[model samples]
Target: MTITQKIKSLPLTFLLLFFTAVNIFGQKPNIVLIISDDHACQAISAYGSRLTQTPNIDRLAKEGAIFNNAYVTNSLCGPSRASILTGTYSNINGFKDNISYNFDFNQPSFVKALQAAGYQTAWIGKMHLGDSIPQGLDYYNILPGQGQYYNPDFIRSGNVQKRYTGYVTNIIEALSNEWLDHRDRQKPFCLIIGHKATHRVWMPDLEDLGSFDDKTFDLPHDFYDDYATRKAAAVQDMTIAKTMRMGHDLKMYDPADSATFEDNIKRMNADQKAKWFAYYAKIKKDLDAKRPEGRALTEWKYQRYLKDYLATAASMDRNIGKTLDYLDKNGLSKNTIVIYMSDQGFYMGEHGWFDKRFMYEESFRTPMVMRYPGVIKPGTAINDFIMNIDLAPTLIEAGKGQAPAPVQGRSFLPLLKNQHYTARDAMYYHYYENGEHSVSPHFGIRTKRYKLIRFYKRVESWELFDLQKDPHELHNIYDEPGSKPVIADLKAKLLKLITAYKDTEAAAIFARAI
Candidate 1:
């Protein structure tokens, strides 16, 4: 038989198996996914922020592509991670909030797909999914919970908890490099270096302490927003003025007075504690001497908060450079795909808020930069709508593997190749952790120029913003005179997205709202 006739005569099952194997083996790129917790795009210089400079992070953008409109399905920690791993929304993955809940490790993760395709997988640092590490990972060294900033206890492979005496960011980088050195060189690997810096109670590395003291950080344009018309905005308790505490968040607690600070540093070794105490002692002294009342104090707290947060980020950026250097030294830079992203976006004192939950631009938009030597062009900026849910699917496609049937996220590989390619027109989001920051559990849809949200759980409120006209999301134009048409259109789109995504609960809630 001729070649075409012989192939046609083959069994259908055999053909399917042959193609699947061929796809898996076609392109075996090593993937390094580095994710930071609660790090905002506004803090990165590549994202056009003047607050701080991140040369290492900017290097990724200078050498690769920077996404301008990357977002998350849920703007919380655990849920966003679940979305990234499973290529599904929080509702589908069953980790809709940060509250205590077990992640179903049996689910089909892209890491498992990579492993099955002859790739070694490892996860280092903070995988804040839960107590148990997910299956299919060859090695893991993760923090027990949120993980500590100083002298953290890491749960290593085989469930062994080991306490390392060092700054969390430095330790994470050291462990990541160690793993890279020991990983099997016979196969391409997928490693996730999860950083615990720039999270809540932002603690800087001792070396980075007082790094931003000379810079006078400016307050956000809407720092004094009164939430005049937006009910949801007015009621949230995450404002830096009221919610961020001096002792807890700003770290202004006197080492000798505040038991919380004393207990936190107690885990550190003598040298670590001594350095920490000595650094904070000066901050405590300055705070006590300049006891400005009212708004002055609030502004002082904001300055302190921003300085500490930026210092933490500085260490993270430095470690990123170390990882990149490892790849270059090993001659793996040409074949490795390095990705840097945050679990979700954070509020950098925007709207006077310090935490994330709302669908506002500051909290909703995440920073994502990727470097794949030959595939993605240098200095490329993509404005397409991409979400955390799309991460797994993209990785699978990059590995020359197909996304599973249940995956809801679409790979933006086409856009990476061609900038003009259009991705999703609208993105969906759901925030379920309510009452934590006095934020109502809400769901919404964001188009390129418009955003419509329904704060449903506690208070029945609707907010619509013409992002083109009001980029800061300061106004609630849902009930405005000329906004009826826009609101109706957005509602229709939101319902369609909910139905298409199989969000049964959100569909029902949206139906009642309409």
Candidate 2:
């Protein structure tokens, strides 16, 4: 081969290389899934939230599809995540609650399927599905359990624990950017970024301290809701009035006491600690001066909780913007699909509750916004009944991978594309936690117009709500006069859903009830 001959062949060689690269990476869209912990739809401005502005999250809604009817199979963190990964309910996934169960890595997962199908995958940040390394990932760096806010420790690949000195949300953003910068560009990739902001003990970033303090939050219309006929609601322990602690939750603590608060903040560096403590010190001083009692104190706590929660969420939203910016700057936005959602919806004083685990709307419905440039039209509002369990199949389908047979969730990719879509008549929900929050184990079904909840075990009672009339679920019309036909139809639908989903335990319970 002479020099002239080699030069002539160069064009063909370059063309072959370009075609190879296209074949490897251009066949499917890359996915970026951002899952924040316990982020309520009410906190996002795009979701009509008056409490706070999540401009970054709103950007996703503005540029893509915002799902109004997104829900979860289970409301708890671990169980919800398990459902998301496996596209199956807690009953089938075997992670019923965060307390008693560890996620079985051996189970069939969409991540495993995607990886097997030649896509690079990684999960970074809060994966609260136990300490075991998550399955089917090229890389993983997860927070242990609920994870800390300040100077948090992350469990990386090889089960190595490393402490990163900064706000958890910011650190996650930095790590995600780093991964995006160095990931193999020849292959399609899926990256799931989990955030620990806005969870319990809402700790804001140094700059975000007291971000929402200037604004006074109006309590929900049912902030002082009386239990009335809702037997399950009457017995739960998750309330801002009682369950939230002053020192731990609201940052109202005397320096001399409150070891739990100390332990929480011990990881902060000297400057971080000083800035944090000094900010809270003023709040404590004002609290001591006022000495608010009874309703005043409860309202005081609610105000603080909202301020801290929104402030913490501000950081998460900022990080989300950073991620979106990265994608746009790198020209990846055209082919990349960005999804932002909470593991499950949270309570902003709805029913005077603080935590999730009930079949109530606040905890059951998650905030989901997705951006797929060519596929999903900008500002498209999706009102179909989509659950967290559908995430695995949807992403799998988007990435050109197949979900396993055991997966129960159907892909909502059609919904995004405005294709022929058949909406489910009802969605099933089950919460298996009998412990924390004292919420009884229960299961129910939610349709477009109605929600039928059966509080089993400790509180064996039925509560039905006409969501069209009482959007807040204030009235339990299960045994009301002239409600027998609706109750019977809902009961039959609930039983059918339980049977269809293969929840043997729920089926047995339903049989006994019938």
Candidate 3:
């Protein structure tokens, strides 16, 4: 071939290379979000937990990145979910708590953004926001309210209610795979798989029942916390000894005696009901024989709680493995981004508590592990402080689209890619519901070394903890000597964050305090 002939073919060669590059780098990636209820980091082995092994959840960290400082704007389930979707705080999003507030679907959401970008979206499992599906999602089959562990009822895409005859965790996993199999193959997709495991009334699958019966858990170091100077922690009702009931929570009561137990038993099929009753009958008999009193009774309750919770979590972990396997078998593993997280952290016998509400480190810091092949390097540990609100923008960016105008969280895509990024020095948290658990309404800021919290509404008091000195937050050194400067700095940062977030009510509280 002559020089002129070679020059004539150069244009076609360049065009071919351009198309290949677009296919390799410019294509949008699929997103898989697996969210669990009340899954504490302390119960997961990936976080160095002594309670249980969570290989499936840990796989995400092994393959991609594990975040050490991931937190939630609000630590309640519904509000955290709302913040994750809208990229805003509870005050801005208007879903402040589980009971009193309804999610405002009018706001911009990440799902809507993904839909606009020609991606199909579906949410299956526990979306406790409402009975009706939110506006942004293309399809859904969500559980109504806090879904049952056995034979749960799911509200489908057209408001059709159907009872699935299986464990809630397994049912959600099956539904997720079903959606994946039937999704529009031409377009990318985002699937949120919500599991109702490790929630209150921890009921494991029939096969998983008594799986942890032999393991004895040591009590948390601060299990007998006297609350000391922490006024808000003292008045609270969330406790393993008092708040957790034998009937409703532990399944150690006769069905006729407890309406919650009766209601739950009625939902299970005959075989499931029989297995559940048989397993608990042994526990009830053992309890009656021992008749544990005083500290013995409390210790028994703690053991039962941990065993049941860890057993329930076992089913969730197995189901997670199934979902990961589905992606692998379908050749979607490479182009798909898989994220495993909880709505918020829960107390696994931390500070003598079973629920999550306070802004302490245990409840405030949620677990988050994200796997994005080729983008996030394997075994990367990110120490940057990121809140749940950041999920919306990060997912939107992954779909190759922009977040909505109202979204507040800046995308953490740069951090995932190991690019130049600015890390947040402090993160803000607020809990609004003073209804359940008697936790006072509070807003606070957590820096790297110090945490400053102010409890208001029912109890107006300030508590400050030097996390470096007291990781468990046992000592409230708000009035300790030599702490004035530190308190002033934290307050300044907290006020700045409140103003930046446009939280007028918090600003008013700050002004009143000053």
Candidate 4:
């Protein structure tokens, strides 16, 4: 008999060979994950942006399956990215906020998992998981907590935090390209290209400042959401009127580079004042000359929003196009899976919000695109209820390997193959309150056409929406008698999901609601 047949008869040898085969096949995908920080899916032309032209990001969606219903388990930054990495929820991973906190590398993250499976793993750009990074990672180039637009400090290896002289955009790409060049060509790799663009205090590169100076954009219909619908929305720290800084945002300054000012600039000397005024003189003049009114003010915000935001996307997309070109040039596109996604979706003046913390559709629905030549059909749309946690399992499945245990997600490989596959009946969402900002702690469930949300530890509030009737989620119908049966059914399912996912708070709330 052949050694393979003899080994199949022998129990230990068969188990060993089976395990070896699983490891070999499971870690074979050359994954290229491109992630942007706080990037609004609405801002990208690929997702439906009329003003912003993001051809590269659009091309990613054009060449791959665009998932219309992908979401993050947690809404915040570190928490969401951690979930993606470990395929575990925030509570399980123990890293919830963006502040200083360590991601326990004990959990099998995709980086570590790929490393274990003999694949080269490298992470570049923003890895805000924690201070103490792990060993055995092939190469790491991470930005400190929230990196800057110009002249950013990056940690090459852990102890070496060096300030680079160039823009962060170019520097990160330089490192990524270098890593790609040095890596073994025969070995598969997993490269995570994370970006620090379009986050808070949106700053653009110098080259992109005058790109959209002449254009104006429109605002959403509900730019003014009356807080009467939800109590927590009433007491939030995020408002464009009060929250936006005037001096930083407006860019107002004196007219000329003179040695003195007209009793105005108090915080500087003659030379310094002259420099400041010279820097912002033109911008201030432009603003003073233009008087925007009514929808114009909203339009101004949209214009400012896009000009500043799309610059980041423009630079980022250019880098992405460069990588795509490299893949094509190197004949790697056929055997590679390329995915571009944000940590979570962001709001582009949707319902008068700037950031994404609400259970609203804008924040809940993320932009997801998958391009795998062997599996996914180009330009396909899958409405499957998938989460960030599912990414690891799906990649593992595509590699023809089993996912590790204790993950609260299912692979969407079947959906990629056949978009009509039915795997999940409902998707659950839970946002915890850490008080960095006053986002109400809430948990909910979203099915194909229905959504139910329950506010926690406060006023015992509930919201129900028939998405078919109201796609915008403008009205809250929690008290409607018509939805009692549906609410009950969903609540039961939510409770079961809580138990399965080990969401202690949701399980408690579910018990109380029952």
All candidates: TM-score: 0.93, 0.94, 0.95, 0.86
lDDT (Cα, tens digit) per residue for candidate 4, span 212-299: 7777666677778776666666776565544444454434434442322322234244564454455456665666799665555555
- Write one digit per residue (lDDT tens) for candidate 3, span 1-514: 9977875668887868766656746679999999999999998888999999999999989999999889999999899999988999999998989888888787899999999998999999998996545787889999989888888899988889999898889999999999999999999999999889878888888998899998999999999999998999999999998998988888896545554346567888888877788889899999999999988999899999999999999999999999999999998887899999999999988889999989998899999999998799999998999999999999998898768887888799988887888889999998999879899999999999999998899899999999999999999999988899999999999999999998888888888852
In model 3, which regions exceed 4 Å deviation? 1-24, 259-261
Which is the winner by lDDT between candidate 1 and candidate 3?
A: 3
Candidate 4 Cα misplacement greater than 4 A, ranges: 1-27, 249-280, 289-299, 400-402, 419-421, 457-460
Best by TM-score: 3
Q: Tell me how far the alpha carbon of residue 194 in candidate 2 is from the true structure, in angstroms, after superposition.
A: 0.5
lDDT of 2 by residue, 258-326 (tens): 553465677778898788778999999999999999999999999999999999999999999999999
Q: Candidate 1 overall Cα lDDT vs. reference?
A: 0.87
Please state the error at residue 129 of candidate 4 in Å.
0.7
Q: What is the TM-score of candidate 2?
A: 0.94
Q: Residue 203 CA error for candidate 1 (Å)?
A: 0.5
Determine which window of 10 residues in candidate 2 has minimal summed lDDT.
254-263
C-alpha RMSD by candidate, in order: 6.4, 4.8, 3.1, 7.4
